[model samples]
Target: MIRVLVVDDDYHVAHAHALSVGRMEGFVVVGEAHTAVEAERLVAEASPDLLLLDMYLPDVTGLDLVRRLAAAGRVVPDFLLVTAARDIDSVRAAMQLGAFYYLVKPFSVAALREQLESYRMWAERLQGTPERGRHVDQDVVDSLYSLRGAPVRRTTVVRTLQPTMARVLEIVTAAPEPISAAEVAEVLGASRPTAQRYLATLVKKRLLDLELTYGSTGRPEHRYLPRRS
Candidate 1:
């Protein structure tokens, strides 16, 4: 099992993250701490395979904690930074200081699972595997670099989709309902015509399933639900 240490100043946040880590099979939560000083002691005592670090701590900044560990000739476990702060400068500094992955707050369980599973696979590859798959090789190398360097700045990747399509996808995925384009537009802050165009795109992408409702109204309205896996 891959041993993990969780460090967060907030007790609830630390416990929640530890619970999430424990839920994944083949992973163990070995320790948790609320302050940078406590985190340093835990890291030394636990010697965890992965450290789920928080950026803010009561005693010191996470970056300074890492620096102090290095200066003290202590062990530095592979790190995954889970932080609420999203400033580019701080993120850049964390990357340079050796964080394997920088996860922003409000991430879903799916996202957390995705990152942890990726790290696990990479760890497996590093343990003297004879031949690594292409995806494994790429993911492992990229993850390492992400830990060591700043992430490239770019506009939101999710916004590349057509506005209506994006809104439709978010809503349907969150709550599946056969919502008309007008309704979707109102909820998503888009024009009715624009919503209609994106709705068609979402249907084309197979992200939404459209159904026509024939009520005694001016026209038959189309509703959409999320396409489940």
Candidate 2:
């Protein structure tokens, strides 16, 4: 079972989130915290796998708490930011900090359930991966990262990929062998990081396969190719 820690400044809201979690299969709320201090203590005691966090806390902000936990070398669990903060900056910050998903406040039970269920399935896929010499192909990685988007397309219209993303996918699909980020960067005349980010995005979208090849440097390098059947 996946243990979860729910943190919110409002006791009633925290209880509501906890109750929602309790109804889900394979998940249990280890504890609920109303402050950063309490949250940290519960984290140390519970060592939960997922944290449902609110941005506003009596002490430090939720993001700061996560940063502190990570910096302190404590158990840093996957986070789902649930807050009334709806600013674009906060959303971008959450994505930058790698929150699994950001959920707005006053969400319905079904809306919350969709995200939670997606996370549960994603977590299961991650936990199911082999431990030794484990390397995930494009499909597995896609299923992991593409968790939330699939539902959208099914319920509505297909979303279009951004130009750079589309180009990255096209380039990878046209490659004869697994292509490195350096090659893609050269072709696009973009910085290596930009190319790498695009490649990573493509891999996550299940449009490209990521293969690691180690050379004389003794460091593994990721190369991308079209997904194989």
Candidate 3:
């Protein structure tokens, strides 16, 4: 399994993210940290394979932490920034620092899963190659960067979701207001979990928007709406 370290200032949010990571196949949350210092220590101790990092930390910025790790000669794991930072400078810095992916805050489970799966594919390909300095062609290099801007082909996992995704998008778009997964399930004659999976997939594709709705009884629930172009 791919071990993951989740870092965020908020304990609740970090724990929630850890839970989500644990739910994903072939991945497990090995540790959680609320500060850059703690995260750095955990990276060294746990030796996680990946990190889900939040940009704004109590001690240092996530980008600065990346730089610090490099400066310290620590073997840095591949990381995806899970941040609320929306500034262009932040995004540019993350790219320059070699973040595997950037995921804005309040993302769905499917969004994180998509990036994880993409990274898994890239990691598998790299591992399959001989480490004795084999020649890598342009196509192999292009595949390594497939998460950025590659044309979708039938063989890719994302392409396989297109057919059912169309139906999910149709249902979400036709709704007058943000709808819950249970409601969608009832409409589509599917189980709640099945409907939730489809809705999360649509959110990951940017075809739907996910929001939180609070009721008097339980934790806030996710509601989905058609994303405005």
Candidate 4:
């Protein structure tokens, strides 16, 4: 299992994030820290495999903590920045400092789950690759860097969708407002179940939002909206 340490200035937020991490498969929350000093201490004590770090800390910035650990020759685990820092400089610094992923605040659980799942795939790939006398090709390097971006295309849903999913996506994008599965089926000339399946796939890809609407009748109906990039 991947041991995780959550660090945030707010005690409640730190605890909440830790709980969320604990709920994910192959991950466990090992510790929580509310300050940079405490985070450093916990890093040394807990020896976590990953750090869910907040950029704005009570004592010092998370970037400073990362640099300090590096300067002190302390082993710093892989870090995923979970903060509201949107400045280009801060993002560049985090990327240069080697953060595995940067998650903006006010994000949904699905977004965080996607990042964790992507990280899992990356770790698995790294572990499975055979060592070749320490030499690496450009493709291997590129694959590693790609984990920091969007969800990997190797996911089963994406791989199975093929060319048809692209057309389904186009129809969804062309709609002016949130559209229902029945509407999509009519537009694509496909069965409702088929359209619903494609819509669910897009939602899982984080490209669409699924909203529930009550019709004052039976169960709530799901409406799909293209997510703003």
Off by over 4 Å in 1: 129-228
User: CA RMSD for every model?
Assistant: 11.8, 17.1, 9.1, 7.0
**Candidate 2 lDDT (Cα, 0 to 1):** 0.84
**Tens digits of per-residue lDDT for model 4, 36-94:** 99999999999998889999998999999999999999998888999999999999999
Q: After superposition, how far is residue 147 of candidate 2 from its true place, in Å?
A: 1.2
lDDT of 3 by residue, 1-229 (tens): 8999999999999999999888876788999999999999999999999889999999999888889999999999888899999999999999998898899988888687778777776676677666766888888777667744233332475443556666776788798999999989888888999999989877865667999988998789899997765
Q: What C-alpha root-mean-square deviation, in Å, does candidate 3 show against the real structure?
A: 9.1
Q: Which TM-score value belongs to model 4?
A: 0.66
In candidate 4, how many Å is residue 27 off? Answer: 0.5
lDDT of 2 by residue, 97-188 (tens): 88989888878887777777778767766877778588888887776788742343321211346778778777877888899999999888
TM-score-best of 1 and 3 = 3
Estimate TM-scores for all models: 0.58, 0.64, 0.66, 0.66
The best-first sequence of candidates by TM-score reads: 3, 4, 2, 1
> What TM-score would candidate 1 get against the native?
0.58
Q: What is the C-alpha lDDT of each candidate?
A: 0.76, 0.84, 0.83, 0.84
Write one digit per residue (lDDT tens) for candidate 1, span 1-229: 9999999999999999999999886799999999988988888888999888888898997778888888999888888888898999989998788677889987887677667766765565467434655345666566444423233212222334555556567876676457887888888887888778887876754457888889887687788777654
